[model samples]
Target: MVSKKVTVKNPTGLHLRPAGILCNEAMKYQSQITFVYDGGMANAKSVLSVLGACVKCGNEIELTCEGVDEQEALDHLVAAIDSGLGE
Candidate 1:
């Protein structure tokens, strides 16, 4: 497993649109991905779970990935987050 923490840079944070995009990207991989924030964890492949986390701009988020392609998954996700969650 691999994990990294990033700050949410988007003003809207992980809402439906951005969160949905994240879920979509995560589902494309055959890896186990999860987002951790506020002492809670959510599946990165679930839009509802991500939105339910109530993340906002400037919040710190930790991404944990485990599987055959963990590194690639992490790299993609880190890029996504760095892109302001595609905002």
Candidate 2:
């Protein structure tokens, strides 16, 4: 398992489109990926789960993954968040 705290940079945070991107990326890996916001954990592969978390900009979220591509998957998600989800 790998975990990293990522700060959401997108102004609107992970909204519908970016959430789709996140879910799509998460699906590429076989890892069981989850994003933790506050005290709750949401499945990264679900767009609804992500939006429901309300991860606004400047919010720190912990991304965790368990499986073969855990590290890589975490890295990409971190990068995506850092990229402002292409605001």
Candidate 3:
């Protein structure tokens, strides 16, 4: 398993668009991707799951990936989030 802490940089938070982008990115890997936020964990490959977390801008999340490509998945996700998830 691999994990990293990242803060949401999108001004609007993980709204529909960013959430979708996150889910899309997550789907690119075979690893199980999830994020811990607000004392809860949400599947990164599911838009609904991410949106339901209500992660706002500046909120910190611990992204975790476990599977064959865990490291790569974690790296990609952390970079994506760091880049504002294409916001």
lDDT of 1: 0.92
- How does each model score on TM-score? 0.96, 0.93, 0.97
Task: Give one digit per residue, the lDDT tens place, for model 3 in 1-87.
Answer: 989999999999999999999999999999999999997999999999999999999999999999999999999889999999888
Model 3, 64: alpha-carbon shift in Å?
0.4
In Å, residue 34's CA in model 1 sits off its true spot by 0.2
lDDT of 2 at 39: 60
TM-score-best of 2 and 3: 3
Identify the leading candidate in terms of lDDT: 3
Could you give candidate 1's per-residue lDDT for residues 1-87 as a string of tens digits? Answer: 999999999898998999988999899899999989996999999998999999999999899999999999999999998987668
Looking at model 2, the pairs that clash are none
| Superposed model 3: Cα runs more than 4 Å off | none
What C-alpha lDDT do the candidate models reach, one value each? Answer: 0.92, 0.88, 0.95
**How many residue pairs clash in all the candidates, one count each?**
0, 0, 0
Rank list by TM-score: 3, 1, 2
List candidate 1 stretches off by more than 4 Å: none
